[model samples]
Target: MGFAVAIVMCALLIASTTESQHNEAILRARIVTLTAENQRNGVALHARLAACEGGPADLARSRAASALLTPEQRAQHLAANGPQGFDVCARMESADRAVLETLK
Candidate 1:
Protein backbone atom coordinates (compact mmCIF):
# COMPACT_ATOMS: atom_id res chain seq x y z
CA MET A 1 0.00 0.00 0.00
CA GLY A 2 2.82 2.42 0.86
CA PHE A 3 4.59 1.64 -2.42
CA ALA A 4 1.40 2.17 -4.38
CA VAL A 5 0.84 5.53 -2.68
CA ALA A 6 4.44 6.60 -3.46
CA ILE A 7 4.01 5.65 -7.13
CA VAL A 8 0.78 7.57 -7.37
CA MET A 9 2.39 10.60 -5.77
CA CYS A 10 5.29 10.46 -8.22
CA ALA A 11 2.88 10.31 -11.15
CA LEU A 12 0.95 13.29 -9.84
CA LEU A 13 4.17 15.28 -9.42
CA ILE A 14 5.22 14.54 -12.99
CA ALA A 15 1.76 15.47 -14.29
CA SER A 16 1.85 18.77 -12.40
CA THR A 17 5.25 19.68 -13.81
CA THR A 18 4.15 18.77 -17.32
CA GLU A 19 1.02 20.89 -17.04
CA SER A 20 3.02 23.85 -15.74
CA GLN A 21 5.48 23.60 -18.64
CA HIS A 22 2.62 23.44 -21.15
CA ASN A 23 1.02 26.55 -19.65
CA GLU A 24 4.29 28.46 -19.78
CA ALA A 25 4.76 27.52 -23.43
CA ILE A 26 1.22 28.67 -24.23
CA LEU A 27 1.83 32.02 -22.50
CA ARG A 28 5.09 32.52 -24.40
CA ALA A 29 3.39 31.79 -27.72
CA ARG A 30 0.73 34.34 -26.84
CA ILE A 31 3.41 36.92 -26.09
CA VAL A 32 4.96 36.28 -29.48
CA THR A 33 1.57 36.73 -31.18
CA LEU A 34 0.97 39.94 -29.26
CA THR A 35 4.40 41.23 -30.27
CA ALA A 36 3.59 40.66 -33.94
CA GLU A 37 0.23 42.36 -33.52
CA ASN A 38 1.85 45.31 -31.81
CA GLN A 39 4.36 45.71 -34.65
CA ARG A 40 1.53 45.60 -37.19
CA ASN A 41 -0.55 48.25 -35.40
CA GLY A 42 2.17 50.43 -33.88
CA VAL A 43 2.04 53.05 -36.56
CA ALA A 44 -1.66 53.67 -36.09
CA LEU A 45 -1.33 53.67 -32.31
CA HIS A 46 1.42 56.28 -32.47
CA ALA A 47 -0.55 58.44 -34.88
CA ARG A 48 -3.54 58.43 -32.56
CA LEU A 49 -1.42 59.36 -29.58
CA ALA A 50 0.24 62.11 -31.59
CA ALA A 51 -3.15 63.43 -32.67
CA CYS A 52 -3.97 63.92 -29.01
CA GLU A 53 -1.53 66.83 -29.41
CA GLY A 54 -1.46 68.96 -26.27
CA GLY A 55 -4.47 67.42 -24.64
CA PRO A 56 -3.43 68.01 -21.03
CA ALA A 57 -5.86 65.40 -19.77
CA ASP A 58 -4.36 62.67 -21.92
CA LEU A 59 -0.84 63.84 -21.13
CA ALA A 60 -1.59 63.99 -17.42
CA ARG A 61 -3.10 60.52 -17.42
CA SER A 62 -0.03 59.15 -19.16
CA ARG A 63 2.27 60.89 -16.70
CA ALA A 64 0.34 59.75 -13.64
CA ALA A 65 0.31 56.15 -14.82
CA SER A 66 4.05 56.24 -15.50
CA ALA A 67 4.66 57.60 -12.03
CA LEU A 68 2.69 54.75 -10.47
CA LEU A 69 4.86 51.96 -11.89
CA THR A 70 8.00 50.76 -10.13
CA PRO A 71 10.74 49.28 -12.33
CA GLU A 72 10.09 45.72 -11.14
CA GLN A 73 6.33 46.09 -11.44
CA ARG A 74 6.81 47.41 -14.96
CA ALA A 75 8.94 44.40 -15.90
CA GLN A 76 6.45 41.92 -14.40
CA HIS A 77 3.53 43.63 -16.09
CA LEU A 78 5.35 43.55 -19.44
CA ALA A 79 6.00 39.82 -19.10
CA ALA A 80 2.43 38.97 -18.09
CA ASN A 81 0.36 41.48 -20.08
CA GLY A 82 2.50 41.44 -23.24
CA PRO A 83 1.52 44.15 -25.78
CA GLN A 84 -2.00 44.61 -24.53
CA GLY A 85 -0.99 46.74 -21.55
CA PHE A 86 2.42 47.81 -22.86
CA ASP A 87 2.10 49.02 -26.43
CA VAL A 88 5.12 51.32 -26.06
CA CYS A 89 7.99 48.87 -26.48
CA ALA A 90 10.82 51.24 -27.30
CA ARG A 91 13.44 49.01 -25.69
CA MET A 92 17.11 48.57 -26.59
CA GLU A 93 18.19 46.08 -29.24
CA SER A 94 20.54 44.26 -26.87
CA ALA A 95 17.78 43.62 -24.34
CA ASP A 96 15.27 42.71 -27.02
CA ARG A 97 17.80 40.34 -28.55
CA ALA A 98 18.36 38.76 -25.15
CA VAL A 99 14.63 38.19 -24.77
CA LEU A 100 14.41 36.66 -28.24
CA GLU A 101 17.28 34.33 -27.40
CA THR A 102 15.74 33.33 -24.10
CA LEU A 103 12.35 32.76 -25.66
CA LYS A 104 13.84 30.58 -28.34
Candidate 2:
Protein backbone atom coordinates (compact mmCIF):
# COMPACT_ATOMS: atom_id res chain seq x y z
CA MET A 1 0.00 0.00 0.00
CA GLY A 2 2.82 2.44 0.83
CA PHE A 3 4.63 1.78 -2.44
CA ALA A 4 1.43 2.19 -4.40
CA VAL A 5 0.73 5.51 -2.63
CA ALA A 6 4.27 6.78 -3.39
CA ILE A 7 3.87 5.81 -7.06
CA VAL A 8 0.56 7.62 -7.30
CA MET A 9 2.03 10.76 -5.67
CA CYS A 10 4.96 10.73 -8.10
CA ALA A 11 2.61 10.37 -11.03
CA LEU A 12 0.57 13.33 -9.78
CA LEU A 13 3.70 15.39 -9.34
CA ILE A 14 4.84 14.62 -12.90
CA ALA A 15 1.42 15.45 -14.28
CA SER A 16 1.39 18.79 -12.44
CA THR A 17 4.84 19.68 -13.74
CA THR A 18 3.84 18.83 -17.31
CA GLU A 19 0.73 20.96 -17.04
CA SER A 20 2.70 23.90 -15.70
CA GLN A 21 5.21 23.63 -18.53
CA HIS A 22 2.46 23.48 -21.10
CA ASN A 23 0.82 26.59 -19.66
CA GLU A 24 4.13 28.43 -19.70
CA ALA A 25 4.69 27.52 -23.34
CA ILE A 26 1.27 28.76 -24.26
CA LEU A 27 1.90 32.01 -22.42
CA ARG A 28 5.20 32.42 -24.25
CA ALA A 29 3.52 31.94 -27.62
CA ARG A 30 0.85 34.49 -26.77
CA ILE A 31 3.54 36.96 -25.76
CA VAL A 32 5.32 36.45 -29.09
CA THR A 33 2.08 37.00 -30.98
CA LEU A 34 1.30 40.16 -29.05
CA THR A 35 4.81 41.53 -29.65
CA ALA A 36 4.52 40.99 -33.39
CA GLU A 37 1.14 42.65 -33.44
CA ASN A 38 2.54 45.59 -31.52
CA GLN A 39 5.39 45.99 -34.02
CA ARG A 40 2.97 45.98 -36.94
CA ASN A 41 0.77 48.53 -35.27
CA GLY A 42 3.80 50.74 -34.59
CA VAL A 43 4.83 50.62 -38.23
CA ALA A 44 1.35 51.56 -39.34
CA LEU A 45 1.22 54.44 -36.87
CA HIS A 46 4.54 55.83 -38.13
CA ALA A 47 3.32 55.67 -41.72
CA ARG A 48 0.22 57.59 -40.75
CA LEU A 49 2.35 60.13 -38.92
CA ALA A 50 4.53 60.62 -42.00
CA ALA A 51 1.44 61.16 -44.08
CA CYS A 52 0.10 63.65 -41.58
CA GLU A 53 3.39 65.58 -41.64
CA GLY A 54 3.23 65.72 -45.44
CA GLY A 55 -0.33 66.95 -45.53
CA PRO A 56 0.57 70.66 -45.30
CA ALA A 57 3.12 70.40 -48.11
CA ASP A 58 0.59 68.69 -50.34
CA LEU A 59 -1.98 71.32 -49.52
CA ALA A 60 0.51 74.10 -50.23
CA ARG A 61 1.25 72.66 -53.65
CA SER A 62 -2.45 72.47 -54.36
CA ARG A 63 -2.91 76.08 -53.31
CA ALA A 64 0.11 77.12 -55.40
CA ALA A 65 -1.69 75.76 -58.41
CA SER A 66 -4.47 78.20 -57.64
CA ALA A 67 -1.91 81.00 -57.88
CA LEU A 68 -2.18 80.63 -61.65
CA LEU A 69 -5.85 81.54 -61.51
CA THR A 70 -7.34 85.02 -62.08
CA PRO A 71 -8.11 87.12 -59.00
CA GLU A 72 -11.84 86.54 -59.47
CA GLN A 73 -11.31 82.79 -59.68
CA ARG A 74 -9.11 82.76 -56.56
CA ALA A 75 -11.64 84.85 -54.73
CA GLN A 76 -14.45 82.56 -55.74
CA HIS A 77 -12.48 79.48 -54.57
CA LEU A 78 -11.54 81.10 -51.26
CA ALA A 79 -15.06 82.22 -50.63
CA ALA A 80 -16.42 78.79 -51.34
CA ASN A 81 -13.88 76.70 -49.35
CA GLY A 82 -12.26 79.17 -46.92
CA PRO A 83 -9.18 77.09 -45.97
CA GLN A 84 -11.22 74.13 -44.86
CA GLY A 85 -8.60 71.61 -46.09
CA PHE A 86 -5.90 73.36 -44.10
CA ASP A 87 -8.06 73.18 -41.01
CA VAL A 88 -8.64 69.48 -41.51
CA CYS A 89 -4.92 68.76 -41.97
CA ALA A 90 -4.06 70.80 -38.88
CA ARG A 91 -6.62 68.88 -36.86
CA MET A 92 -5.31 65.52 -38.10
CA GLU A 93 -1.70 66.42 -37.33
CA SER A 94 -2.67 67.59 -33.87
CA ALA A 95 -4.57 64.40 -33.16
CA ASP A 96 -1.70 62.20 -34.38
CA ARG A 97 0.78 64.11 -32.26
CA ALA A 98 -1.42 63.69 -29.27
CA VAL A 99 -1.56 59.94 -29.80
CA LEU A 100 2.23 59.79 -30.10
CA GLU A 101 2.66 61.75 -26.90
CA THR A 102 0.50 59.31 -25.01
CA LEU A 103 2.61 56.41 -26.30
CA LYS A 104 5.76 58.08 -25.06
* Clashes found in each candidate (C-alpha, N, C closer than 3 A): 0, 0
Give lDDT tens digits, candidate 1, residues 4-87. 999999999999999999999999999999999878766654443333222454556544654577544545544563433244
lDDT string, candidate 2, 1-104, tens digits? 99999999999999999999999999999999989988997787544433333245467764566658754455455446545454554576578779879989
Scored by lDDT, model 1 comes in at: 0.60
Instruction: Please give each candidate's TM-score.
Output: 0.43, 0.52
Name the candidate that leads on lDDT. 2
- Candidate 1 minimal-lDDT segment of 10 residues: 46-55
Which stretch of 10 consecutive residues in model 2 shows the poorest summed lDDT?
46-55
Q: What stretches of model 1 exceed 4 Å from their correct place? A: 47-104
